[model samples]
Target chain A: MSSLEKRLAAEKRFKFYGMFAMTLSLFFVLILMYKIFSTGSGAFVRTTINADVYFDPNFIEVSSNSSKKEIMKASYVDLADQVINQNHPGLDEENFIKVREMYTRKFDYQLRDYIVNNPNVIGKTVNLDISASSDLDQIVKGNYPRNVPEAQRKINDYQLSILDSLDSKGKMSKTFNFWFFTNGDSRDPETAGILGALMGSFYALLICFSFAFPIGLLASVYLEEFVKPGKITDIIEVNINNLAAVPSIVYGLLGLGMLIGVFGMPYQVPLVGGLVLGFMTLPTIIIASRASLRGVPPSIREGALAVGATKMQTVFHHVIPLSLPGTLTGTIIGMAQALGETAPLLLVGMVAFVMEIPGGAFDPATGLPSQIYLWSESAERGFLEKTSAGIMLLLSFLIIMNTVAVLVRRKLEVKW
Target chain B: MVDQNSNYALQTSEVYVHYGKKMAINNVALNFPKNEVTSLIGPSGCGKSTFLRCLNRMNDVIDICNVKGKFLLNGNVDIYSPDIQVETLREKVGMVFQKPNPFPKTIYDNVAYGPKIHGIASSQNELDEIVKDSLHRAGLYEEVKDRMDDIATGLSGGQQQRLCIARAIAIRPEIILMDEPCSALDPIATAKIEDLINELKENYTIIIVTHSMSQASRVSSKTAFFHLGNLVEYGETGKIFTKPDKEQTNDYITGRFG
Candidate 1:
């Protein structure tokens, strides 16, 4: 072959290599997305059982004249047990317990709440929807293997038969799991929701951005525009870049030693977590901000300075505005990275199993990644799906953040 | 030292520029006469632009650049005195860069920035009138009158250069220093800039640095030739082009060598 032919063949080979690499990466991403979606999709729907619960006064031990406090304090477990035994008569104690385990443990509390909220329902039959146990829910959703031996299966033959009967009668159904989005963490995965972790992550990011952005911007401006390049400035620049690459968990240790240990701040709160993550994210914002500030063409600075503007005026009026889009893009990416960070948060006490939704940044809370870590550590079959679902939520937030970064860069970047 | 002439608007003596020990401009004393266009002509890297930036202390922006000089404006004010504010000096001596460096702002804002910052205009109407008059003086108002709010970067290269000139003039400086203001333009645009310079010298003392010797002859009344960071020749434009006394100036003007 001629030399030209060899060159063309080499070009073709390079193109093919690039295409293969891109396709391989894309294939991996698709597999990951498919795995997450398939497993987590089950967590978005919950299995519920409908029952005609008769509010018997004898079982409730509450008369029509009974006070609301008396009704609330009444033995609701007995009433629920009676209702289950009435549907399946002549059951031994073991079978009875198995049947009772099909519904959520909190059904008694739910029944008491219902009666206290509605006093006129006494002595009348009311149709109600009850939450199923996590094991029964996994079975109902077909996520659990049914062909396994009776000893191996979580739902045994008898319980399966009862569930099949309920299914046949259309009393057992799958509904949108609105509770999964609204409730906080729970030992029972069926009742678990992301609202607590989501809020914790939100507050942490809010605090992180509010703390890091202005300080990072000002530091970068001072270093990039005002300070002369010398031994100290050079040392500072090198250390700032080095901090960006340091293990984030080290920042957590620093936060633990200083913010919690020395300052005596509360632990497991997003405020502390946010402050820790802010320390982790500060170097990133400063490096990115300085880079963008450097990218602002020197001619623009000269233009402003030539107009008899002061150095501060030139920077604030021209340099900062021109670099803002890049600075913000960098800041958001840093926040996204902080959102997915777990080890630093784990050290900062954001890994605590918080069950109530955090009302404020100072409240005890766990971020989404730590929540996923907690759920993934559970030995329950139900938590497997919950883990994937939590991952999905976290990944979606990352995607949204990255998309905003790109949009901001495209929208605000001056073409000149 | 050059002769002390009261007719000169600006005078600099014993000016030396060092960039961290490497000399860029040697001791070159030159005086710019009042209301006349002077062109500093040199090849690339001859420090013509560096000398031009020294008049307003624009070189102070470079950390390693050390400029030692004595500059007198209007034969009285010591421009380099420790008490003098650099911003105030820049207000008196404005500059246009080699590139058309307009701010990424509206045409009106680009022109109004200098006046606004210097507090030359007290009211909106006064700033508007200043902007309009500057643009008209720069020969851009007629073409861009309807699009004053449009971003200045959207204009053509020549128009952007003109807008920069207008921005420099809006503060009503007595002297305008232009560093190769037409090097980035085509022939037609360069011609337009040369025409604008001729008209501007009636009010502002215009000192331009140009590489094109023909541009020096066409636009300037006096010319200074810098070679290897040294002032090789300085004389009237007519003498410099027709009968230069220095053999080096004659050789350079006759295209013998840079």
Candidate 2:
């Protein structure tokens, strides 16, 4: 072949290689997105079994005038058993207990809440929708493998038949699972929600941003604008750059040893988690802030100084304001990265199963990633969907944060 | 110490500037007469701009630049003295840069920045008056009067340069140092700036650094020639153009060599 033809062939091959690599990466991303969506979409809806529940006076020991606390202390298990027996009459004790197991453990709490809220409904036959158990929910959602033998499957033939009968009668249906967004973590997967984890992450990020943004900005400004370049400053610069590359788990270890051990901060609290994340995020923000500050043209500084502005005034008035949009973009990108981090949170005691929504940064809580991590380790079939759902939530948050960063840059960026 | 009775507006004695180990400005002593336009002409890298920066201590902003010698403002005040506040020195000696480096702010703010920082205008009305007067002096008031709130950078290059000049004059400095202010402008803009400089000589001591020999003769009464970091010639513009005292100055002006 001619030399020119050979060169053209080599160039074509190089272009093909680049295209292949791009396509390969895009393929993996598409597959990952599809898998997460497919598995997680079920968590947004749950199965409910509607029944005529008699608020039987024989089982309910509280009167209409009874306080909520007194009503809550009544025998709810008997009430639930009596209601389940009424729904499935002619069942023996064993079958009656099995039928009662079809409902969620928190179904009793739902009944109790209903009676507590509406005292006029006492002894009345009320039509109520009860949450089905996670096993029944999986069956209704077609997530459970029915092809497997009854011995190995989560639901047996008898239970499946009963679920099918309920479905045929229009008593069992799938509805939007508001509790998935409202409730906290629970041993029962059907009742678990992300509100606690969401609040935990919110408080942690709030504290993280408060601590990292100003400290990083000031540190970068002092280093980039104020400090003269010398041996000491060169060393400090190298160390700060190195800090950005350090493993975040090391920062978690530091938080555990210094913040929790030495400082006596409570374990599994968002405060310590946020402080650890802040330390992990500081170098990122500092490096980004310094880059943006350096991007400010020297002409602007000279203009301010030539106009008799002090060095501080020159930086604050002209240099800093011009670099602010870029600095904030970097800060938000760093915060987004911190939001998805899980390993460091594990070391900082944010891996605990927190059931209550965090009231403040100091309250014990688990962040979204830690909650997802905990759910992924569970043995239940229902937690599989919840794990993917939690991951989806975390990714959406990252996307939203990065979008805000881009929008802020577009809005506030100065052309010059 | 303040010296009000001196005939010269600024005088430098044996001023030497070094960028690290390399010397940029040699021993150069020159006096700028009060209320006159004096132009420094030199080829590229000849230290004319460096010497101009030394007058206002603008060289202090460079981390590696070292300037030594006596910079006496109005014959007696030592500009480089440790007791002197740099801000006050800069306020007294305003500068317009080579490029039209107006702040990315409104036209009014660009003109008002110097006076605002120096606290010269006591009220909003006073600041507005100073901004108007400075813009009028820079010959930009007629073109930009209707758009005072618009960003200064949005204007044409010539207008931006004029806005920078207005910004400098708003502080009402005694000496105005312009370093190649017309280099980035077109011929028409250059003519307008030259005319503005001619009108400004009655009120301010103007020291301009230019590469154009014709510009030096057009705007300045006195001209100084710098060659390779050394002041080679200092005379009237007519003498410097027609009959230079130094052979190198003659060679540079006559298009023989830089």
Listed per model in order, the count of residue pairs whose N, CA or C atoms clash below 3 Å is 0, 0
* Deviating ranges (above 4 Å) for candidate 2: A56-78, A113-125, B1-5
lDDT per residue for candidate 1 within B192-212, as digits (tens), equals 999999999999999999999
Q: Which stretches of model 1 miss by more than 4 angstroms?
A: A1-5, A53-96, A108-126, B1-5
Candidate 2 lDDT for residue A352: 92
> Model 1, A190-286: lDDT tens per residue?
8889999999999999999999999999999999999888999999989998999999999999989999999999999999899889999999999
Deviation in angstroms for A225 in model 1? 1.0
TM-score of 2: 0.96
lDDT of 1 at A161: 93
